[model samples]
Target: MFDIDRWREIFQSINKNRLRSILSGFTVAFAILLFTLLFGIVSGLSNSFKSAFADDAQNAMFVRVWQTSKPYKGLQTGRTIQLKNDDFNYVKDEYESKIQYQSARIYKNFTLKYKNEANSYSVRAVHPDHQFLEKTMIDEGRYLNEKDLQEKSKVIVIGRLIKADLFGEKPALGKRINVNGSSYLVIGIFSDEGGDNEERLAYIPVTTAQMIYGNNDYISQINLGYNPDLNLDEAISFGKQLERDLRFKLNIHPDDQSALSVRNMAEANKNVGSFMAILYAIVILVGSGTLIAGIIGISNIMIFVIKERTKEFGIRKALGAQPLSIVWMVVQESVFITTIAGYLGLSLGTYLLSLIGDSLEEDYFIKDPSVSTGIVVGATVVLILSGLIAGYIPAKRAANIKPIEALRAD
Candidate 1:
């Protein structure tokens, strides 16, 4: 209902007590502002963590070996540990059920030249399944196939940035690029969300690298994606078991991490999951506390305002004003102040978050911090309801007072 008279009265009351209204509104606004910033920052941090691991498949694991740090059986410290085709085959055959995708990696640094444009890029020779393990997206042409490995084909998959650098606007697929001194066909152009470093590298068949580069079965690392059906705990357990078996088979000390180690994405995921859970819980608590404080502050202010207006309320009652009208007026005024103040706080918080976009990513790992619309609306609704309650309780009591007694409230 359009009640102009009622609205006019509310405006008059607010105008008369500007300082009191501002104080009440300030409390609510400050609380909401704090709540918004806390949640937004935490959300950004969560995003950063997720993107940090985005380079590899969530189920991926890497087996890397280096020079031994501890003596084992008859072997002395500093013994060089090398992963070979045999070690890769052992994992593939033994843990076939536990593994989804498997690839052996051999690292190389080679200068790739297409016509006159040339640049040195990191090259990784890997099995076909390496594409999935690294989450590499084929933008054009196809990744390495089994035939390439068997035939030791001189073919390579270049990254998006590599193509840009070497081929410019020209198409790179099916073109021949000089690698080191040998000419290799470009089978694919790929992109990676892992960022520019990944996009500057290239991949070739593991056999091709072994045959041309070293003529040996030596591999740099073993990469595998655990079966996606397994839960984090199960995947982590499988990784640990595999690490132990590989260590025993290689005759390395069981505790020698440098000699044999498996970097499991599952363990990292679990730790991150736990950390986010705790972080969200803490934010909920602190946000809730701030809101409660706001509600309490408004409640106290409303009580005082009602006290100050008791004599006026009695005079109006004496002049035939209904008790419900008095209660409604106070409730309406409370809701208006809280609603406007809350909106201002929400807007300020959102604007601050937008300004902070990616600025904290490098140092603090907070990215794109902001609250969802539903949550902001929900919080606003809560504040409105709290204001209604704060006004109703005291106004109702004051409305029910006998006119003479209310007039004598002083």
Candidate 2:
């Protein structure tokens, strides 16, 4: 299959129109470069979204109570609805099999002190299961245990950033810190989540929080995780039923429109999916435009080359060269130039993507932009196809020319 004569003729033809060949190659190279960059950016956006959402509890739902915005069921408007321990227990009992984890939270903003070092911080009182609901991982020591909750132990788990700020690389285990003038033992440090403000907070058992903060009768929010096998509609239906039961048991009107709010992770995922879909569409459109332009440029340049070599092609045909050979000669030239230039462009784009991918730090978008192996192979295939297609028409035109007429034309 090694045809030295054919390769030599192809090289001679390209050398005869070196500048035009290079220009044609540049067009294909630029197209591939644009396509690669756009694909990488889209991939980065997808990766960033995944990273941002990975820490969140899967299939989770949140519930909150607020002042009634509308009067219903004989209750006057403006009545405030609040959740209590009874309501949390009722929901758990009703949906025990369907629920994976559940927790109630009481938040307080207070000043924490250790000797002379003091800082204003937020504290959360949560159940042991709250760790699962929040997908929090312990970096050091241990998280609150059931015994801590049952006995109302004055133990606390600080976020990594909080630990760094308050203790500064020093081991913080067994250390005592004052929270709102109440002494609590630091038992554990949470893993860092990369610039999350939540990393600056501290967590304590629900009972200890109620004892010290005296908010046992009130909870600011409730978080629940459900089995992923259930559809969103089924989970939401179950969640709404629980919400109604809680409202009724707590003396809140069932028809109170704004007294209770329920949110599911499914809706959040749908929104994210829509955003990614639109972004991918835009990237494909831009990349396709560049590719088409390059293909057209290649077609025009091949046509020009055919016109310039009309006499030579006629002479070869007159000497018994086959029409397929003539077509292969032109196509080989196109493929060689485009492949070499396109590869260079692809390499450059890949290098740039790798260099900048890790440096991106935007919130929930554009992280780790890099080309995958499949994408590289697909782009190469497109370039090869473009080369053959661009040369086809010009090759046909050259093959149809009569030797006598081509020789006679000035």
Candidate 3:
């Protein structure tokens, strides 16, 4: 019900003790602001971590061969394990249906030149499907295609940094650059926030890389993207199986020391998730501490308000006002004051977060710090509860005071 009289009475009472009311309200407001800011910070940190690993496809896994730890079956332990072209072909053939995308890469650092302009940078030799695993973006021209791989064409794609260094903002596509003294045409430029600068590095067909780099049939690593819908555990099992089968077919010891390494995006996601949970827990602890201090301050101010309003309470009782009505009056005043002040603090906090969020870089843990609508609502509810609790004890004491005694008190 709309109670004009009740509002008027509450306003009059608050106006009589403006300083005390303001102080109490400020406490709740500060708590809400601090809590919300902490939540935003934690959320931002988690988001940044997730973004850093976004280049890799979800549920993707990487596999590379190294030396073995122990002798497996009849193979020697110290033998070096290398991934051969045949092994990659076997994996592709055996697990073609289960795989989403797969690519083998041979990478090395070499100096690239265009006329007299030369820069030493890393180069990768990859298959057509390598683009899928790389999350590559082509800034100009086109990426490697199946035809390029099959023909062992001297076509190359460069990273943005590579392009900028070699071509200086000029179009790099269709230009020929010499890598390790051999000329290759630039077919595309790869661009990303944090990736191999396409301008600085060159990418070529895996076969070409083998021919130029002297590796012949050797590959450094194989990257595979799995369907996200598949169970992570099952995917991991499938990867292990591929590893075992590849090692067996390659005449490499299964337990060859440093023989093989596998990295899975699903596992990374799980680890990141665990890290976020811990970060949020710390944020909550700190925010809760701040909230507790604010609540105590509000409670103290409410106690003072009750003491100052003893005479008013007595006068109301003398006029036959119910005990619950007196309680409601005090409780409403606390709620109104805290709610307004808390909202002001919340707005300020949000504004600050917005102003600085975009400028946040990857080097720092924090990123876009914005609280969700649910967090805002939850904070508002918490403020309301704090106000109610702060007013409760004082309101109860006022209600119990004998009208005669309160009226007599100076």
What's the TM for model 3?
Answer: 0.78
lDDT of 3 by residue, 50-134 (tens): 6787666776788887667777777666777778888788778888877888889887888888876898898888987777687
lDDT of each: 0.90, 0.82, 0.80
Number of the predicted model whose TM-score against the real structure is largest: 1
Give one digit per residue, the lDDT tens place, for model 2 in 64-155. Answer: 88898776677778888777887788788888898888888888887888877789898989888888877788988998889998999999
The TM-score between candidate 1 and the true structure equals 0.90
Residue 376 CA displacement from its true place in model 3, Å: 4.1
* Candidate 1 Cα outliers beyond 4 Å, as residue runs: 311-328, 362-365, 399-410
What are the runs in model 2 whose C-alpha is more than 4 Å off? Answer: 1-11, 40-55, 194-196, 215-217, 230-257, 307-327, 341-374, 392-410
By lDDT rank, best first, the candidates go 1, 2, 3
Root-mean-square deviation of candidate 1? 2.6
Candidate 1 overall Cα lDDT vs. reference? 0.90
